[model samples]
Target: MSTSLSSDAAVTGTRVSPPSESRLRSNLVLVTLLTCQLMIVLDITVMNVALPRIQADLHFSATGLSWVMNAYTLVFGGLLLLGGRAGDLFGRRTLFIAGATLFTLASLAGGLAPSAAWLLAARVVQGIGGAMAGPSTLALLTTIFREPKARIRVLALFSGMSSAGFAIGLIVGGLLTEWLSWRSVLFINVPFGLLVVVLALRYLPRAERQSAHLDLPGAITATSGVAALVYGFISAASHGWGNATTDISLAAGAALILAFLAIESRSAQPLLPLHLFRDRNRATAYASMFLAPMAGMSMFFFLTQFLQDVLGLSALATGFAFLPTALLMFTMIRTIPRLLPRFGPKPLTMTGTASMVAGLILLTQLTDRSGYFPLLFIAMILMGFGIGLAVSPLNVIIMSNVEPHEAGAAGGALQTLQQTGASLGLAILVTIFGTTSRGAGGSVQHALVSGMTAAFAAAAGIAALTFVVAFIYRNPRPAN
Candidate 1:
């Protein structure tokens, strides 16, 4: 069979023919899509190593520094469903290219930001670009790879790359911040984003838009609700959880979310189709996706501070400390496709979540005199391997049975949960850290250590929920 996709509808108002039969072109399409996914996921943690520098230079307060990440995730998580629906109603390739362009521009603006507010604004725009492109990346994958085995292999690679990108961002961000400046992290995305656009325009096949309308009201409620929720939690870090503003924001967020669910249920064309929730495997995957990342993202946030503040590690050292986890994740994910067919997602997800919980529990035991190899190293390796086993398989489970028409929305929903999990998880964890730290003696090191330990304990509890969720799939469903 010919590997090229459908012929272009038009370019420069001139119709173009499909490329001749070539497996290489098909492979290139997968690579390009994977690269875009990597870039988007990478941004989530790339600036982490540079947070202290960004805070000092941009005059961000300690509590406010978390916003550097929350800002991007809030909008990315909120609008992702709308972005995916737009891709379905418009064209995936068109949105992919446009999103890449906007992301590249936003990265440039962020790199040059002169103040905290300026940088935050750029981050918001960057998140919008991410929301637009992230889901389409997977939707395109489903479109191009029709065969089951080939799709599984490529999706495994996609999942591995996404996981690795977070770790790679840490190391790269560390090196750039230490050797050059913190701005290098944002600037690094420019060339990669442009390359993705150019290749997508050249090789990616275009899909005709489905006859669906974008859910504007659904988008607004979801986006606003998630943002408000994150803000409320982060506010708790500063003003205490009992503050009036925090209570109001939390209440408003809950009401808005309920409103969103009501709207989604009644809309003739729901932003998130209700039927997708009916599938036990997919629902399990989505639930785990939300909970797993809460622990995973907290590792990045708290560990960075622990290594730097407690262990007296530099930014570069802190970044490199995460390398073991990245390496393990990359190595482990490649094995999931082979293992998944035999054991089913249930065993894999259960074992993965179990490992993650173990890692988080170990992290909670850290002390001022703890050695890296005995305490932190073992925990990182376990978390890395566990996440590897969990994440890729979960992706396959979620996307496997989705219809081509619903692929974008399915992908959007998966990613929305992932990003929201990261944002809110970090916020809640940060609040825990803050609350605990304040009660410690005058020693900053003791305070920070206490906070991180408390956060890790809480993260372990969140991660444990995944094991219960994984057990919900009493019998294994075929990957399809």
Candidate 2:
């Protein structure tokens, strides 16, 4: 279970590198990490396609069905920091295995659920499991691959998988929903999870545990703050921002966050180090990660609704509609490692954010009469390429300043921000879309189109802000 990689010349210095299993072992490591990541990422969207079937089977109210997705995201996003910190304090490999096992079991429970409550309970557990395992995937990768050249390549692939997995999930969900039962979407995780667990057990190197204590107060306040904040935003879509519950939740969330910050500053071992944000590059990277996913995830949410409701596309077709974006993202990610040395993070991220803005702006022009061929297709491609180029490099820069020991915490923080941003962004955009569509009082298609355009415009504005952040980001080499 524990392997010392100090003997490998490829992994040297303060970091432990694996033995020269060379290409094969390297490939195995990548596969193990990527598979685990894919399982976690794909689950976010896989259930989306099956929502109608789930609602029908469980006799869920329209509003209640949304919880099927929200339950997972809320819990997952809220607990990521704790999970990441745990990986650092405990062992990454140990948590990774534990997470994978829990996820697999939760997926099984979800698939076999006899009622709405059962499935929702299962999803909550799935979120917990995902939070536990998700951060460690990247942390372990950073630990295993220390050589810059090899690391970039692996990072590129990891980035591609992360971006592509969501799109891929839509496709898988559509296929399973149409061909098998909706339950199959949940069932699909069993094999993938088991594979990750097995491979991780066999190939993943274990790190020594730290003697550091968990910041229990920081964890409690941070998790509660984030969870409450996310809940408020998501609820704002259903209950207007003026609603008492939404207002109270938002107020409490803000208070708790301030408390978490205060606790973190004083804690001997903070759940999230306040010092990590002191680095300009890491800070910029974190901000960009939040904004990029915010826009990107919102696109998925509304685009699915637009394609299904306005264009009259089937769930299966809607999934394929995102294919161009996914394909281009994968293609761009492979090219990023080569591009990084030439341009560095600034130009790449600036260009990427600019592309996303352009794509989103174009999407804002969408009308009910708009065709998929040149308009939506091109936009998706641009967005995907933008996400690939921007996110992967941002990840590199984020980790660039971090010491090896801080990798897990940094990785966890990065993912937590991304997820929280996704949830927050989608909720805000959904509220805007709903308000616009309702105010229009036109044909459903026209109203929906109008709402989508408004959401896209807002997303573009967010992306523009990210571009500004990327432009000003400067990474001065730390004095040796």
Which is the leading candidate under TM-score? 2
Can you write out model 2's per-residue Cα lDDT over 349-381, one digit (the tens) per residue? 888889999999999999999888799998998
Highest lDDT model number:
2
lDDT of 1 by residue, 107-137 (tens): 9999999999999999999999999999999
TM-score to true structure, per model: 0.93, 0.94
Error of 1 at 209 (Å): 1.8
Query: What lDDT does model 1 reach?
Result: 0.83
Instruction: Show where candidate 1 strays beyond 4 Å.
Output: 1-21, 61-64
